[model samples]
Target chain A: MIRADETESTIVPRIEVGERLEAGFEWFEDTFDSAINWVGSTVAYISDGLAEILAIPDALILTVILAAIAWLVRNWKLALGTVGLMLFIITVDQWNEALETLALVAVAAAIALIIAIPLGVLAAKSQIASRIIRPVMDLMQTMPALVWLIPALAMFSLGMTAGIFATLIFALPPGVRFTELAIRQVDAEVVEAGHAFGSTPAQILFRVQLPLAAKTIMAGVNQVIMLALSMAVFAGFVGAGGLGTEVVRAISQLNLALGFDAGLSVVMLAIYLDRVTAGIGGGEGVLAKLLRRRKSAPVQTEETAEDKAATGSPTT
Target chain B: MTDTASNNVAPAVSVQNAYKAFGRRPQTIVKRLKEGATRDELKSQGMAAVIDASFDVAPGEIFVVMGLSGSGKSTLIRTLNGIQPPTDGTVKIFGQDITNVSPRQLRSIRREKIAMVFQHFALMPHRTVGQNAAYALEVRGISRSDREKKAEEALNMVGLAGYGGSFPHELSGGMRQRVGLARALAAETDLMLMDEAFSALDPLIRKEMQDQLLELQQQLGKTIVFITHDLNEAMRLGNRIAMMRDGRIVQIGTTEQILNDPANDYVAQFIQEVDRTRVLTAGEIMEPPVAVLGAGQGPRAAHRLMREHQTSALCVVDQTRHLQGVVYEDDVAAAVAAGAEGLTGLLRQMPATLPGTLLAELIGAASQHAAGLAVVDDHGRLHGVIPRVTLLNALADTSAEGAVRTILEEAPA
Candidate 1:
């Protein structure tokens, strides 16, 4: 065996890839500064509006409304968890920051989905689009969440707007990938059946493919929401105020108790959002299933409740 | 032939020189670009699913296309409706050339003229039986209430009444197939293309469905192109059967004609395993009665007739050739010894059979009657007779010699 030193085995780089990437970012920041600011401000407007709306009512009243929504959308267990988590954040004096984080996630996820789903459908429908979008998606996913903030801070100044812009970009790849996959996964025989029945191509897409792919698309939405929530702390580095700012403040001051409270509140909020979206994706939500049942107007099977929890995902 | 000659109208479906090959274009191009590639080399790059398939179906006829798996029968059916477009051919449906029509025109033709039934009951898993049946009507822009009404009628016709509210998964395999049938029936098109529609069913259910389809066809008189791999089914339902082998139709004729004169060794080997009992009717196997003694003749004439014909029994028929009874040689001898003047003293009631009775059905009658089973016309006149030896020969013969014997026996005497 030969012993080797870390510096002795290395060779000098000719291309300097990292420097070139930094230069590329600087060029993009200089060239598209106004366009980036406009997008950031638009995202900021939606996020601020959502935050103001969520923060208006008393903490108690807000908790009651959220618990009611959880009950209607999910079940009794999720409703109780929502009520408990909201009260815990309020008791720890982190209610305002928690709502801010929630609003940021909601706006970022909404925009990401709005853009990603159409691109994904385009990719699924055409081979050229699919070949082009795949490698771009891989790059978006493989890059670090914090790396997105650098460009955001360069183009849009330090604030919640920049934070939201970065978080939206960081959490977009899953939406596109899963949407394309869901559309591609539809059974070919079902599509052929549609054609055999004399359906137009557009009719086949709307009636057959979209309805069948709905559950998987909802799963993709759940992924987008979860990713946005996870990226909040990274967004805090650029002065995006929320629970993340509190954690940063606590850490700088070496206040363990404060840091613990803020971190625990973030975890609680993440769980609440995660479970609600997952329930929706799995078709376990009472409201969606009830609506579907009403349209068909058949005798309801007892296995529906069980089927809802069992499908859409196998990992759980 | 004369019945068909009187009608100068066009055929219901005519496929001319149809060819379908399966593979991507780039692969064939790459193979063609190779050095010193021969014609066979380029041919090997793509699979020929159907090669120059051509056939004509008369109006209101059950034209069965029969083949083993991979023989391109399904592909041939798909080409009739433009589901799988032929590489080079013209398919005319009700005198309209499908290749010359626009996609919109073809779609309208499919909606108005042709309906198809699938093998695996290609029903929407999410829809109810009635909603699945109404799918074609929904595509045609019919109102929901009207679609439901027509779907209910179709379901009732298929003996699935009151099943409108049931989902497809809630039904058995046979019932799901009936829903598929009901879907096709609801369209009420001039032509129906059934691609192994009953092949997925259990044997008993398949038999019942075949009978139901036959009865419905008799009443509806719709021109149907039925494709199946089962020789028995082809024989049972087809007005004219086309035997396909390796993507080509080897022979096209009635069941009896095909059995008697196969076009080639492929068709001969294809039908070698077919059960003759199911495929042969009494009319195909029944022989002319050996001796017939008129009712006005005496027992001496009956005995003399039996002796001359070298048979033990003679049929007693009226002056109009309507059968009255059978008299054995022993009975005739006894009557002759008693000095009987007429054949009525020696006459015994005959065991009669319809000309359309299956040979399988006649086996029990032939064994029980001891003399023979007499094939009778509707007017009670004896057409032919199936002796014990003939029934045994039909059940025992596996060689093509049996076909030759049938032809010889069926010839005018």
Candidate 2:
């Protein structure tokens, strides 16, 4: 290896790529100032509305409702676990911040899905659309979640709106990708059957494709929500309030106690949301299975009786 | 149903010079084909799924298109329903040219007039059997109660009456196919396209389904175009069978016509693999009785007729051609020697077979008696007779030489 001081040789000239990118961002901000502001306000309104609604219910009452939902959708075990997690958050005095975080994730994931699903459907239905959307989704997903906060902060300033904006971009790719994959993976023969019966393209998409793709799409929803939750923590750098703010505060002050409490709360929330969403996606949870069995009991008996009668006859 | 008026009625389905090529630019492939390019020459451009196919299916007739996989039979059936439009030529459903119809118009035609059954029982997994059966009507925007009622009736027709509430995955493969059949039946369309509908079922279940379909056809008289690779299935179900090879239909005819007089070597070889005993009917193989003695004639006349025909037995029929019985040579001689005046006393009961009875069922009865079995119609009128020799000959004649000779005899000069 040659010493740097021994020779002066330049193999390649330095490029102004970073300057051009910065200029591009400035130009975009300048050109779309009003549009960006309008979007920011809209996002702020949604997040604020959700946060207010979450705040209205007493924490205990909300916890009980959520636990009940968990029981109905999953099992008693998950419900009990949710109760324990909620109590822990309350005990640590992080309940309000946890709720704010929940509201932020809900808003981000909802907005992301509303846009992603249709784009996914369009991509799945048309080859040209798929080719165009795939690379963009790749770029969105592969780019660091922290990178999105830069543009978001520039557009919305330091607020919940900027946090939601970053989280929405961070969470959107899986929603679009999984939706497109799920729709495309639907049985071709089934789709053909739909067409054979003279169903319109819209009817087939709604009736056949969507129903079959429901479970997979639900998995995508889970991924979006989880991603939004993770990205919301990083949004604390922009002064977005929530558990993320506490986390930022603990990090800056080197308060280990605050860090542990906020981290535990995030983990608990993640686990609760993940299990509930997964149970919904998998379908036929313990309670659901029991209910379905009870409902179909009479039909099952009738089917067996008919089967016996069929076997008894020699005509076959 | 009069023969003369039948000519004026439009065929339920018609394809004239229809060709389907699979690729982005199917029209160019079709153009090359019409310009006398062979399938191999155009292989690089696209796959020619169907080439110059033409046929007509009459109302209430089962027209089967038979071919192995990749022979374009599936593609051909799809064209009838406009699932895959032909690259060239015309397709007509009930005399309405579908080739040029707008997509909306074609869809309405499928909704109102046509139904299809898939080989794989492409039923919606999420839907219950009843819901799956009701799907066609549902797509047509029929009321839920009305479509459900129709679906229930169709389910009953296929012997799946009470299983409508069950999901498809819960049912056996055969039962799932019943749901598929019920779906089509509920549509109540005059035309049905069955793309190897029973191909996925167990052999026993397939036979049962075939029987039920024939029984239903007897009552409903729906015009059907059935696609299958099995020659036996084609022979059993088709009123007219079209045999395809390499995207081209080589022959189209009734079962007997195709069996006894194949159009080409490929068809000849195809029929050779079919179990002749099961496919050939009594009427198809039976010959005219050697000689018939009128029931009013004397024993002497019966003996004389037997002698004149050089036969061991003779069929005795009334003036209306109703079969009385058979008078063997020995019985007639004994009656004549005993001075019997009429042939009735000497007539012996003989086993009779219906014209539609399969030869496999007649082999045991035909072998025990040397005189042969009498072939009769529903009215017990004598149609023909099947001698033991003819039965044996028919079964053994599936040899390559015999098949070649038959093909040669049927070939045009």
Candidate 3:
């Protein structure tokens, strides 16, 4: 009887595969440890910078971010909860590390959006490019995000670079997929109208498609930020430092309070960003107007090709 | 319509053998590449969206392209602005071949001399109404103040004066459409492409807008290529109508020529549901006036006058000769039989609401009541009676055109 290992041996022969897997894991673990430490340190610096710029106490930073978000979302209750979460993180005396984690997540998410949106647009407009890049995106989205650490460690050799690279891969898919989908899903009638006005392809894209897709692309950005937060915590396994590094340190030392505080801070930051961005996407509608638009805009269209390639959009 | 429009010279648009296609043919691109092919072969794969469509839009005339959905009116319209290029033939705007022109030239032509109003309006959701309207001028890189001024002027022209600051969602459908018109006008074009622009509006609003557009065209003297599926709208708006089917122009002619002397069964079917006289103006059939009666003429006097003229009715008038109700002989005879002597006649006594009354309503009202009904005024004074022959003739003419209209009216649109 043929075993699954026999089938795999044909693909990659001549090596003791189990040994190779162990060796790869060892390499990943070593790189992961140092990457987490570096990321943690960078996070600390960013947090300090944010506190100074905003003129808030380092401990109050998360609370302020969440409170601002809640205000924007018009959810005073949620805003108060964000304040409570911030105060809780401060009680654990990990406020500085928490601010660092927030900054890392913010920068990673921004970089992801900047790269992904343009790529997504390019994918939408070109059939050849879309066909080539779609399978790669599928693999990125489907493979366990831990796989990113393997490649990231090999290339970056452990530090903030490895942490950022890993966070970018995990958080990047939504931005590309959503931006592509939004642009492609622009109303055909509107596009034709643009054409009839003698708008060049670029003009139609930037003026008509992008503006229409703003909400969708923003949704992608929101997902990237959330995913980046999740990945940032996991980056604790690497040497790159952040609150993730503190959590790792606490786990190693068996300090439950520190680990729990770090974890909850991450959740608070995620909630704050998610709510704020979502409120923006929801638009400046009266409750009645929101209900009407929500009921109607979705009937507008569900997906574009960008979503189809990245699979971030369920409709695609 | 064509002759009058073109006699002045320099047609606004002319399409000669234009064709468009989508998708590939029998051989796929990969297969062709393996077999070693060229660009022209790859282009032939697409299905023809528009095929050999030829027509000229004369200056200051409303040229309507009428078709059922997917008849390539859309593709044809897009070609005028150089959005979609024809596989063969040339599209000339003011005798310049727009098909092979540079992208910059196309954009310039669109900015300066051509504007389009789409079916869905296409007003930007993110922008305010003024912003959407000013977008064309902005694309031409106009000054902010200059563009705003142009947009404001256009808004007032389209009757959307204060809607400038509002977003598209804030405006009603009619108001949004007005914004669309303003956007087109802001382009300051000599030709306007209206692709079913009014089809989405409510019926009353559609009529009002159509009338407003006609009034605008008359005043502005701009050429228009209007595409629609509604035959009634075509009849109402088109100076010269081009009926398309399956990406081909089936017939092209004036409304009267298409109706009265239908080129084919399709053209005949189109006007079959129309009230013939309504499609016609009073100017079409008016003859030189010959008084059938003198100043002292009574009902009896009008009767002899009509007989001599071989007409059943004669329009009554004062010494100033203002139009009054038409007097019918039978109405006079009936009033005489009723002992209401020295009175109005049949057509005079019967009520008339001008020649524009609906055929159905007139038929229903005059169905069996033939007492030579008094054609009264707001004061209920007799003017003239409606001769049965005149009503019958009008009905026959309308029902003939109305055959298509009845078929459409019963449709599931």
Choose the strongest candidate by TM-score: 2
Q: Indicate the TM-score of model 1.
A: 0.81
User: After best superposition, candidate 2 residue B361: deviation in angstroms?
Assistant: 1.5
Instruction: Please provide TM-scores, in order, for all candidate models, with all chains considered together.
Output: 0.81, 0.91, 0.75
What are the per-residue Cα lDDT tens digits for candidate 3 across A1-316? Answer: 6664465456764546767867887787676878655764564466446535544554466467758666655566767877877787677776766666776677678778888999999999998888877887887788788778876676556655567778888898888889889988988877776776667778888888997898898788888888998998877777556788988898999999878878887777677778767766766423324432321111111132112112211110
Best by DockQ: 2
Q: Report the lDDT tens digits of candidate 1 across residue range B205-230.
A: 99889888987898888899999999
Q: Write the per-residue lDDT of candidate 1 for residues A67-136, one digit (tens) a residue.
A: 8878877898899999999989999999999999899888889989998898888888999999999998
* Number of the top lDDT candidate: 2
Task: Find the number of clashing residue pairs for candidate 2.
Answer: 0
Point out the worst 10-residue segment of candidate 2 chain B by lDDT: B1-10
Model 2 ranges with Cα > 4 A deviation: A1-24, A286-316, B1-8, B288-297, B308-310, B317-324, B343-345, B377-381, B402-413
- Which of the two candidates, 1 or 3, achieves a greater lDDT against the reference? 1
> Worst ten-residue run, lDDT, model 3 chain A?
A307-316
DockQ of each: 0.20, 0.33, 0.18
* lDDT, residue A8, candidate 3: 40
- Which structure is stronger by lDDT: 1 or 2? 2
Candidates sorted on DockQ, descending: 2, 1, 3
lDDT (Cα, tens digit) per residue for candidate 2, span A23-115 = 999999999999999988988888888899988989999999889989878988999999999999999999999998999999899999999
lDDT score, candidate 1, position A207: 72
